[model samples]
Target: MPGLDLPAAATWGRLTTFLAVYETGSVRAAADQLHVTPPAVSAAIAALDAALGTPLFGKSGRGIIPTDAGETFAGYVRKMLGLLAEAAGAVRDADRGRVRIGAVATASEYVLPPLMASFIDEHPHVELSLSVLPRDELFARARDHAVDLVLAGRPPRLSGLVTNARRPNRLVLVGRPGLKTDPLTATWLLTGLGSGTRDTALSLLTRLQASPPLLTLGTSGAVVAAACQGLGVTLVHEAAVRAQLDSGELVSYTVPGTPMDRPWQLCTTSEPTSATRLFLAHVCDPGRVGAAAFHTRHRPQG
Candidate 1:
């Protein structure tokens, strides 16, 4: 039989079905969306194949995967769907106002709430969505248009974004209540095994000429917990474990001559939307003190 042709056999429904399976990568999942049985969706795929004279997907272990051709096609399909959604929204919407913000887990939990609360109070009608992710994920999401802004510790270099909310992060060493250390101890416990903190700690160690640390942790909170159990010494953000310090569960140690500081920032893509601008303005307003105010108001008694 001669190969079937697109003009003779194509339909919008077949394209929609193909795109659905392509996006989700499963026949059963596509079936769930169309409210049909898996076999029915498979039949649609068969019809689409006969019409295009090419296979779109291959069956894998309990799932479906798109062919290379289908993968390329799916990209265009997603673009089309996005454009369609945008067009439909443009026609029906009057005020398209929503800000999606991303932050690292620590910043989201400890730093962003007061800023966000102030923003919402200023613009009560604006919708807000906040995602608490890891450092890399937060920046990646901002790059990919998934979020309007990202707030995290300032990385060395970020492409396609501007540093707007910059502050000097106060980092300090913490140890158990009675764990004594000489001014020139060789051993250390570096918080965050990740590269940025590791590099910073290594530089500090190099300057101090201290030996490699006994432990390297992946989180400041873990460092605090370990110190509480008298595990070892670790460096971390002062704000992160401030409560523990005030309660005498952890105590800050002076680093002799080293200034304990790191830089933090709020980042947004170069071409920020109106929503992003509003959020940035509210968070960094000079006169609008939120968390900074709270910390100043209830500073721990010396």
Candidate 2:
């Protein structure tokens, strides 16, 4: 046991590193998650431990385990980090700030609305704009700094772009209930070429070298409608098709390598502005937003 004296170890960087390590239980994993070197994470942890006069972690054979004290500290750390995000967002919105974001069709259309709503509710002074673009165009704009941030499914490896955070995403192969299972005989449905769902389907079909009768619908909604009418099977975001799937209008099929597991990445070019950072943090850390923000809207006033 060591003395629990609060000292100079309370710096923001160390707190962030500590939380990452506490959550991940691995220095290497925390470093990768924070986009920092392993040594940096180790140094921060060691400094924090020294300040508190106790080691936060202990070696458990081949793995590291959090100490009893470490677990106790984590409860407070979570609250402090949440407040940090809120305070930073509020202060950053002091100026008339603007941020431009580009995203793939699925992310922009289905994923970002609630997040944007929560951000707008919290930072009413901040102005936000969104652009829906193809994957290549999104990266092109991100590279040239035309867009401040991008949200999409797994970015391509490129120089100078930084991925700030990643969230889980799912792509499922959905069709009418008990529909034909033959890919060769079925008409493969597709949305616009800009759509990620279209890309996933095209990539799978390409790899399988099976080109069925193709139906090019313009939008995801329309494609889902066609699939409901038994036009063809389509790959789409699982969240997007949940209603139909639940009602027996649509059913997910277990195709090879699907439903595909993927990640929605938040990325940016060099040195994003404070506004962009605020939005990025808010979206990536959904728990950071207070529940009151969402409920505050459309509440009946006394």
Candidate 3:
């Protein structure tokens, strides 16, 4: 049969060299393009011809012309190479087409809405999914590769994670606008288990040497809402309750060493997905994030 020999030892190099030679119509020209010697190109073509049991080219002056079989084979080889390139791109497109972004409740509630909206507007084709989890759960998911990017207060140091962006974060004690209850003896609203806010709140209490009446709430939102209704006083991330503070729904109390500095961080694994990188770049850009995302003119008391 005047077809391929189907030798088990046949290598991809032969077909590629044959195609390169076919394209340039000269061994030396093909060798230059491939960054190999003319002898190497000729040897590749010879090996390919031997495997196929047919000479794929014929002499034409100083150049070469494909035989009938070589001409036919070039078609299949061209399609094969084209399909290979397409396959590679298809795999990468999947990664680039979707973004998995996770954040702690405070960041998601306060900072992410506008930033996410802008990101969607800019990259309309990307499918974005956002999850709001407790700080510990968020970092755990990051370790497991279940999520692409994370935003929260300075997370505990972990291997294989990188903090890509940072901004000032302040935790403050807040209550209803005109509450006269002394914070030292007032009921302290605390968040539920697995939240960083609870630990921070407790630590602040220890520092102040006051153990007020404690109320356990399931979420920061719940705690803040409870405080607003004059139920009790609560500790919250300033960014999380920015809207409330500005609207006079909540008042920051004056306390020594209040407004503790806990920086908001955007974190990702050492190796991140293509979509993650795109979103990371967007969030890091000051122009994209805008002043309202984190910067505010209102003076909050805490």
Candidate 4:
């Protein structure tokens, strides 16, 4: 096994058995999970151990446990299996002309609906599924290939994904009319933790040495709604509250170094599906509805 090179098919089979045994703690239990005989499970593990030139498991009383090397190798096996499953899903979705998309709250609430409406109108045959989550969870789903694409603020450095900045995302501090006080002094209505809006608000507050928020809402819409009721000042995406700002229901404040700007990005796997590519083009095309909705700029008054 000095230069062991197992066949891909055998490797997958062996790894599958190894994972089952590692998880179940016994060959018989692994066989039960795989709908195979205990001897078959034992044979697969033996084959894997022989190929790797190392003992993967050690026998205990009526059970088995993975060795240190097996533990380290199991991580890679899980990733490989996950990738394989994603590949299968991608192929199925491509055949069915389906695209799954994940978006952060702001994009889901304000940006995607109009664009999706237009896209569906044009590409009526494409089946679409969209999930709106916090930025962190959205990125996680994108990285896992649970969604074909993700629309959100730019994610942190991720190795296996590609992020294209589709438009500018502007964050502004907003409050009701006649409430012109220091942002630090006013009660703050914030979105839940892990949202892009909340992250921006926390950063701005930190820079200003402001106190913690008085209240927290789960969604950006709720935070804006609370602010509109004259409850407290809140930092939110300008796109999310454009109608209120335009209607004078809420007024924007120009805090020092205000309007933190970031990019609204389209994130996808390195090898995106055809459906993903089609949707990305639709969003990026300047003449399309997505571009207009995403790129529209709003100037805030102090």
Each model's lDDT comes to 0.67, 0.76, 0.78, 0.77
| Clash numbers, per candidate | 0, 0, 1, 0
Best by TM-score: 4
> How well does model 3 score by local distance difference test?
0.78
Best by lDDT: 3
How many backbone overlaps does candidate 2 show?
A: 0
lDDT of 4: 0.77
* Candidate 3, residue 175: lDDT: 92
Each candidate: RMSD: 7.0, 15.4, 19.5, 6.7
In model 1, what are the clashing residue pairs, if there are any? none
At residue 256, give the lDDT of candidate 1.
Answer: 58
Residue-wise C-alpha lDDT for candidate 1, range 180-270, written one tens digit per residue: 6552362466555443554566777778777754677666666678778877766666777889889999887777544465556778777
Residue 70 in candidate 2 has what lDDT? 92
lDDT of 4 by residue, 129-151 (tens): 88987777766666766677888
TM-score of 1: 0.64
Ten contiguous residues with the weakest lDDT in model 1: 293-302
